[model samples]
Target: MPRWHPAILLALASLQLACTLLLLASEQGGRARRFLAALFTSEEDGPFDYSHPVDVYTNLSAGLESMGGKSMRDPVFLSPCPVVSPLLVGPISVQLSGPVNLSIISRRNPWVLLGGRHSPPRCRARHSCAVVIPHRNRELHLALLLYHLHPILQRQQLHYAIYIIQQAGNQTFNRAKLMNVGFKEAMRDEEWDCIFFHDVDLIPENDRNLYVCADGPKHMAAAMDKFGYKVLLAGMKISRPSIRLGRYKMIKHKHDAGNAANPNRFTMLAQTRRIWRLEGMNTLNYRRLSREQLPLYTNITVDIGPSEKAPARRLHG
Candidate 1:
């Protein structure tokens, strides 16, 4: 091989010198310092002294406390509603319930025990929430949903009430219209800070997922067990006070004939989005009745569903 060029050699020497200076500077602090210290320093130069009668027991105890126990800075735990913390657990399986099981649950947790339209007295919840369920011929599913949801909501320390807006008649199910009606009706009864449009088939698995609202619209059912713990856009839409990540079990059911491969599904969704942007909750032309003490389970029949008399084109409007 030909002799190496003198200029190249000088450049290489300069690079080495620069690298040495960088390594020296890296020893000052931060991650680079730690890495360089680990790489270059010997065991003798390390901070720990293995020979100096190491208080292994004391150190181990401290380490354990740091890892497993809460510190003084930690917030006080509220009964039924534990202090909110970052969610570390993943999606879990949930056992489904029938009407009989629900009736048993209802007996055990009567309107008085269930707090009716309010939360437990001991729970100083942060937000007053409304869980609106737009329903039609899904009583069994509704019962199951109520059985599981109340406990989770209570544990989350949310002052929440559940409303079941059932659609009457054999007309095509208008989910969006029912949702709008639920919002209006729930608001009429109580000054809910957060409104959750919940589907009757979905049940939350973890209580750590707080029911409190956020700054914007929140999609609660991100990771669902039905979709192999994948993020989904189904179930529960939060307005104003939105929400974040939460897992739920979506009970599978037979698709309605009206919803079977309905080509207008996307169009309806798009129209709703547009209408929400334009009018929001004010678009509906219903008179707000005076506030009433809504019971634990109250059914208000409204002409909110799609009308069979009206033309099919005006259904979305």
Candidate 2:
């Protein structure tokens, strides 16, 4: 029997290992190719110009650990976010005529929860507001307003949710009645500090217009471009004369279907004091067709019955 030389044996062993690796690489396909490429490639050959050795495994482990640590710790937020939110970038341009993507808005504000609810992550909001929009057949207007409003609400650093109270039938749209329904529904969801009756066709122009109800009741809509910046009561009309807090730019639009101005609206208005207590939220009878907690808002469709239905007397008082 002949004895093999040690150096020759070493060389043969190395060749066998090399053959094994080649076989494994061939069997494993892309994964093996990437592993081999990474194993042989120098840091200098990579797309990134690293000045120092980067321990990728260590970095990845550290990142995972850091995320885990963050998950364990409770997030501490400041209460009553600064009056002038640092997030505000005032007077953003609005596009009226265009396709607005609700999904994109949802992605942009990741903190917003299901049913279009958001609270500032950095601070506890001064006030929690429920924004109620009376809607019918104004899909474009609704989409456009929501596209513009979500970012504004985020910037304001206030806790808020958008509720779209849509009338179900082809009857004359009752804006005030829907608003009353919205108020009732909104309260059912949360003990909100205040409710803002928002019109679907209005898009706010500035982020400085905070949605917080600070003092007593406030009338937010003071001026509009549609009405030559005049005080239009039909939509968005009030605030301190000096401050531009609650101003909104009414989207240029005509009356929507089923939403034509009621000829007797003034006549109804004149009888407001007479029917104020009985016919508001309590006396109304409505059937809810659908209520969806959508990604961007809480949508509620209701059959408000015929416009001429006799008002039910208030159960209370």
lDDT of each: 0.55, 0.68
Residues 1-317, candidate 1, lDDT per residue (tens digit)?
Answer: 88999999999999998986786676454666556656765432333322332111123223223333323212234343335522222222355744435556555343223324544344345677888888887877877777666645644445678777766666667666777888888787779998888888887755545567776566667653221111123233333211222556688899786534445655644455334344435656443332333334556666643432321344554
| Ten residues in sequence with the least summed lDDT for candidate 2 | 53-62
Write one digit per residue (lDDT tens) for candidate 2, span 1-317: 99999999999999998976886668566676676666776532333222332221223223224333322322353445676666655556676764467776566555567899977664567778999999887888898888778777776767899999999878989887898789988999999998988888777665666677644445556553222121233244344321233446677767755777776755665555556555556687788888999999999999888765333445776
Candidate 1, residue 108: CA error in Å? Answer: 3.2
Q: Worst 10-residue stretch by lDDT in candidate 1?
A: 225-234
Q: List the residue pairs that clash in candidate 1.
A: 218-243
User: With candidate 2 superimposed using the best TM-score fit, by how many Å does residue 215's alpha carbon deviate from the native?
Assistant: 3.3
